[model samples]
Target: MSKKRYILSVALIILTLNPIFSQNSPKTEILLVGFDHLGQMDNGTPSSDIFSPKKQKEIIKLTEKLRTFSPDQIMVEKEPSEQKQVDSLYKAYRENTLKLSEIEYGSSETYQIGFRLAKMLNLETVYGIDHYESTSQSLLSSGKNIDIFKNGLLELMNTARPMKKKVQQDSLSIYDYIKTINQPKFIDLSHNLIFNLPAYVINGKFSENGTNTVDIGKIDEKYIGAEYITLFYNRNLKIYSNILNAQLDHNSKRIFLIMGQLHIGVLKDLLEANPNYKIITTSEYLN
Candidate 1:
């Protein structure tokens, strides 16, 4: 064989013999956009009205920017149980037959970011990947003397308050603001706030027994505060499972997830450990 033909023959043999090369597929590119809950997490502070003309214009620009990712699948913080209802709502929004703000929890970031961008991309549906079981609050209230490391948590929030105020004040456009919070620094800060709660341990550590009893102190061995925070973390883990199990096309290469800041850090940590995924940060495309 000629020199060129010999090299081509060698390459063909390698390609045919190497199962690794033959089986390789594009790594799924996932962008987890950490977002504010609009109002649910506002903690008595009302979020700026996203419904205003100025904010609406900013949202349009933000959606257009995210369109660059061309995600084959989009996930929201909503519960999977709401999937059917949200699909109908998304269809109504697409057909101009309904306004998201008219219904309950309609003005959530799921609609503002997930639904808005999905529609802009002309995608058929969005995925819901949240799991909510409200045991944290009850744990806090169940104990007779639940410390909650109250001072530490308070100090943490007080420190974060200024930055939170600036973001909520509309000092920056929606696009810029989302970019700001989704930064790795901010995501870490938001996540660490809850870890303080686990330090409020007393005697032995235990999770809820689901005995229909309110007083956990009666159990004799209870880690009220640790269990409180554990419940929150448990919910996030379930959310992670939902993301992994979401039904996407076999050929889908990109997934865009929009969820609250607290959940993002945990999810990012979980996703980065998986070799099948590549975590695309907000700074990448938004810039």
Candidate 2:
């Protein structure tokens, strides 16, 4: 082939391969910020009152730090079905026509963190990516020799109680408390509490009374503590799906996900597994 013809052929090949190569590149940087429920919503976990002026000021400073990430999208732990309602409120808030505190929205991290950050960044709207699934406690009640499971759960709560109390009693800022909870040490401990509770039952920790024996033949049919953990996993998976469904183009789109602290562990695992995303820890930005 002539030199001119060869050059033209090379250019066409590069054009054809550019998109394929780019597709393999990670374009989305996601900062998964695990936060406590500011509204005190009942999740069997301790809650805080974030509506005070001092707390509000702290939140603003925290948002300022997060703004350095320059996120293009902010995702909150609200249900996907509530996106329209959230968007409406966000739009009003951005226009300065609606005050979030006047409308019973002050207690939620969604408004305090997500909405505040979006406004500070001059973004249009915040995205809600929450999905709810009820984890039935009836399983705990039904098993014959389930005292082991009950004891295990109580131990787990007891383990977490001090940290919860410290946050409230020590007068730590909401940002500091969240930063502590999202640390790798805390995340791993939390995961162990959830997974180990069920494992205790499976390992026959309650078998001393002969009442703790789970029917091996009917294991799949019966409800167990592990199933409770699975429910939480499923919920986080659905929330991740909602995050993905937002359909942001994978080209350097920075996503900030503000969610309950417990969710951080699972969501981090899921996001880390995806090639399209690069996970950013709260420590990286908060510091």
Candidate 3:
């Protein structure tokens, strides 16, 4: 009788601990791809000058690998309007609106890659953010120059701005960063790549004369680099939280988010939110 009781007690203890442990540990596979650029159009081929063809091929191969898990949903960094445009096309599979062949150069690559994967896997893609048109329309209504703002942002990212490294105490949260930077007024801040560089560049190239570092006036590269790094760290925290919440809200079993490398850096925070999913990357499963 004592022996039976001991086994029963152990079983009870495990049952109790299981729930707690399960809550603390979740498993979700997050495959993060760092694309060459975030331009508005959809390009079939990635720029070898910017990111190598080898890397681009690897990304596609990784996309194929994702099919094995069979993701039910995909979240993109594009605005709602753009997302809708693509979603509509995918639903119809063909429309006069835009041809898959029409997508070329920098802007087109994102859609091509995303839709290709979606079609191959038959997953629903969700444009997880507010529409750019809504934001642009609001800005226009306020008599703000949307063109200037857009141009400024494009210039900031493309022009060689020297980034320096330094720890900043400001809130690292994406919401806080956007608020602190007053990003609504700045159109460029809307995109993830411009805002989240630190997380994406895993093997960060030392750029003394790169377009990304063009804006540092007289300030040493160290400070500029630090500012850029801080920006991404905070942005990643905010975005990861958003993605986690979205996944929970939708009650999705498998979700694959294609964002910059930087945002996907916070895997632990992401896993904590969705504690029942397995977290893996293209690199991990592929090579």
Number of the top TM-score candidate: 2
What is the per-residue lDDT of model 2 for residues 144-225, given as tens digits with 9 covering 90 to 100?
4466656655664675666666655535677777777788987776666555555444422112222222222334324455
Candidate 1's residue-wise lDDT over 151-246, tens digit each? 445665665566556656766676777787788777776666565555455564443543223233343336555655665677788998888778
- Comparing 1 with 3 on lDDT, the higher-scoring candidate is 1
Candidate 3 residue-wise lDDT, 1-287, digit = tens: 69999999988778658843454544445544443233421133333221344434544664565567676767666654465675676665433355554554323334545666777876665545311211111111111233443454465445312210000111122122212222222222334333443233232223443333223334333333334444345545556656666666666666766654333435434564655666654444333
Q: In each prediction, how many residue pairs overlap at the backbone (N, C-alpha, C within less than 3 A)?
A: 0, 1, 40
Task: List TM-scores for all candidates, in order.
Answer: 0.75, 0.76, 0.46
lDDT of 3 at 175: 20
User: Candidate 3, which segments miss by more than 4 Å at Cα?
Assistant: 1-26, 38-62, 80-83, 92-98, 103-109, 129-230, 267-277
Output the TM-score of candidate 3. 0.46
Backbone clashes, candidate 1: 0
Worst 10 residues of 1 by lDDT: 210-219
